[model samples]
Target: MDPFEKMSLVGLRRYQAIVKAQLPIAFSHALEETTPWAEKALERLQKRENLVTEAIIKLEFGDDPDLGSQVSRSAAEE
Candidate 1:
């Protein structure tokens, strides 16, 4: 089985939080001109962050019957 499939809900949330916390650092690095590859790395990290966040939301609420409305409400709040 895949690592993500094996991860608990709490573990997935924690991992997502960790990735979010790293966004500031990644953004800062991306702003620097010294490292030519920093922007590419940051883009990859952002993509990973989106995937993890999506996974968390799916695992937490995908089974809910009102998932569409719930997601819309949550997205609005954000």
Candidate 2:
């Protein structure tokens, strides 16, 4: 078996059952704050650069075939 195929960075293996009992979809890789301020910053970056977009997230996880293959959308997407 591969070491990282199903690897989860932040799961508590010992307490997974307890945690799952409370929240069904606990995240593995956490995203930074997506507050209004962050959204505005993202917008500003997008305006300043051609490649800044939500699809970049998929590009960032490019090592994982499942996520990497999700592919990026055209920059013109709404």
Candidate 3:
């Protein structure tokens, strides 16, 4: 991979790890808030986390045409 791609993969991995680690804490806080907005925010975070995970998988395992489309869609949504 080119330097930029390598860096991007590293960054994505770091972000995925951070998000995975924080999810439980976030869930607890969201539950404590007990508001629709809090639930919505948590849901958004989970969606982003899934995208990052897919991106990481794509990078690590080489391209999958379907995953390429999925990643593109996720990026567009962002």
Candidate 4:
């Protein structure tokens, strides 16, 4: 973004042939940088899925079974 902004300031704002040419390369680099972090987050969620589900169930059905059932029914309908 900083490089693109520099290019824009250096050249015409309305038409940036250089920026347009480099957009895909820049986007690819950005995705490459973040992909690992995203993958790790997804892996962590997958690993903890059962524990998270148990926590949610406990919270939902803690004190009121009727309310929990209503919520479950509404969510199912949706």
Candidate 2 lDDT over residue span 3-77, tens digit each: 223434232232333433433222211225646665665554444233222224333455576554444343335
Q: Find the 10 residues in a row with the least total lDDT in model 4.
A: 1-10
Q: Give one digit per residue, the lDDT tens place, for model 1 in 1-78.
A: 434776788998888788889889888988975486888878888887766766666677775758845774685477
Better of 2 and 3 by TM-score: 3
Q: Report the CA-based lDDT of candidate 3 relative to the real structure.
A: 0.74
Report the lDDT tens digits of candidate 4 across residue range 12-54.
3323333345545555655677777655654544434333332
TM-score of candidate 4 against the unseen true structure? 0.26
Rank the candidate models, highest TM-score first: 1, 3, 4, 2
Q: Could you tell me which residue pairs clash in candidate 4?
A: none
Off by over 4 Å in 4: 1-15, 35-78
Model 1 misplaced stretches (Cα beyond 4 Å):
1-3, 63-77
Against the unseen true structure, what C-alpha lDDT does each candidate score? Answer: 0.75, 0.38, 0.74, 0.46
Report how far residue 22 has shifted in candidate 4, in Å.
1.2
Which model is ahead, 3 or 4, in terms of lDDT? 3
Supply every candidate's count of residue pairs whose N, Cα or C atoms clash at under 3 angstroms: 0, 0, 0, 0
TM-score of each: 0.73, 0.24, 0.65, 0.26
